[model samples]
Target: MAIITVMVFILIGIFELTPLIKKGDIKGFAINLALLLCSCTVLTLKSLQISVPSPLKPIENLIKAIIE
Candidate 1:
């Protein structure tokens, strides 16, 4: 199931990247690829039941401390 999900993401990424590659948009393609990879990694991890630590926790804590 996780494999299937990752494969689907790969297909979606390929579909999305085709236009940028054809148009010679290097910067846009790079940014899009980076974002797509990051999202796919997160989704794959989640599908595999992996627990990812959130970066926002410290910020939230800081905000709470300031409020108090």
Candidate 2:
């Protein structure tokens, strides 16, 4: 799960940064850098097995209910 989270963050960071880098927008580049840092922090938390409640768990249960 931690690997999955890291991969997702990396993909998102690349997606966000690519356009900014292409446009030569330094501010956007910095913002994306900050986002990358935050994502890394999250990845580190996951690596440490710091469990937390799933933010989407309730939504998932709702979907399951509808499906059932």
Candidate 3:
């Protein structure tokens, strides 16, 4: 399951990067690769039954404090 999940992400990353590579857009490729790596890591961890924390909690608390 983990391997399959990672492979899918790898394929998606390849498809995403091919166009950027063809256009010689190094910046775009780098940004996309970073995002792909982050998402892939998160998804892979989830597949392995790891708990992921929500980064939005702090932001949500800040917003609530400002509003209230």
Candidate 4:
């Protein structure tokens, strides 16, 4: 599963990121790569049966704190 996830992301990078890189859009390439890597890591971990904290947890906590 992890391998599959990585393969998919690699394909995405090759196809999607190639154009951005060729265009010399460093900022766009960096941002896209960062987001892709983050998502890829999370997906890979999940595939490996690792527990990943929900992103909404912090926002929920912040809302509770504000209400209090």
Candidate 5:
């Protein structure tokens, strides 16, 4: 499943990101690549059953600490 996701993301980058590079839009290229990488990492982690802690946990703890 992770392999499948990677291949799919590769195809997507070839198609979608090529235009950004060809047009010399470095900012657009960087943004798109970041988004692609983040999604791919998350999906790959999910498929591998690796536990990723919730992003909001720290915020929740901070709020609780503040209230107390």
Candidate 6:
């Protein structure tokens, strides 16, 4: 999961940062890539636990309450 998230972020970063990278701003590119990778890793780790609440569950409950 963590690896998948990092890969996704890296791909997105490459696409979005191409302009800055092409203009010789290697530092900005590196920093953004590092940040993206770190964020994805953290989020993936957080998602690994089985007991975490599903984000949609609350919304579903609210809708059910309204319907009933």
Model 3 segments beyond 4 Å from truth?
60-68
- TM-score for predicted model 2 compared with the true structure: 0.58
**For residue 11, what is the lDDT in candidate 3?**
94
lDDT of 5 by residue, 15-65 (tens): 999999999999999999999999899888988888878899999999999
- Measured by lDDT, the strongest candidate is 4
lDDT of 2 at 47: 79
| Global lDDT scores for all candidate models | 0.88, 0.83, 0.93, 0.98, 0.94, 0.78
Q: Candidate 2: misplaced stretches above 4 Å?
A: 51-68
Query: What are the clashing pairs of model 3?
Result: none
The TM-score-based order of candidates, best leading, equals: 4, 1, 5, 3, 2, 6
Mind giving the per-residue lDDT tens digits that candidate 3 earns over 1-68?
A: 77998999889988899999999999999999999899989988999999888999999999999999
- The C-alpha TM-scores of every prediction are 0.86, 0.58, 0.80, 0.89, 0.86, 0.51
Question: When superposed on Cα atoms, how far off is each prediction in RMSD?
Answer: 1.3, 6.4, 1.9, 1.2, 1.2, 5.9
Q: Which is the winner by lDDT between candidate 1 and candidate 5?
A: 5
Question: What is the Cα-based TM-score of model 1?
Answer: 0.86
* Superposed Cα deviation of residue 32, candidate 5 (Å): 1.2
Residue 8 in model 3: lDDT? 98
The sequence of per-residue lDDT tens digits that candidate 4 reaches over residues 1-68 is 99999999999999999999899999999999999999999999999999999999999999999999
The candidate with the higher lDDT, 5 or 6, is 5
Q: Which ten residues in a row are the worst by lDDT in model 2?
A: 39-48
State the weakest 10-residue window (summed lDDT) of model 1: 1-10
Error of 3 at 33 (Å): 0.5
lDDT per residue for candidate 6 within 1-68, as digits (tens), equals: 75677678778887978987899898987888778867776677776753545679999999999999
Kindly provide the TM-score of model 5 when superposed on the true structure, using C-alpha atoms.
0.86
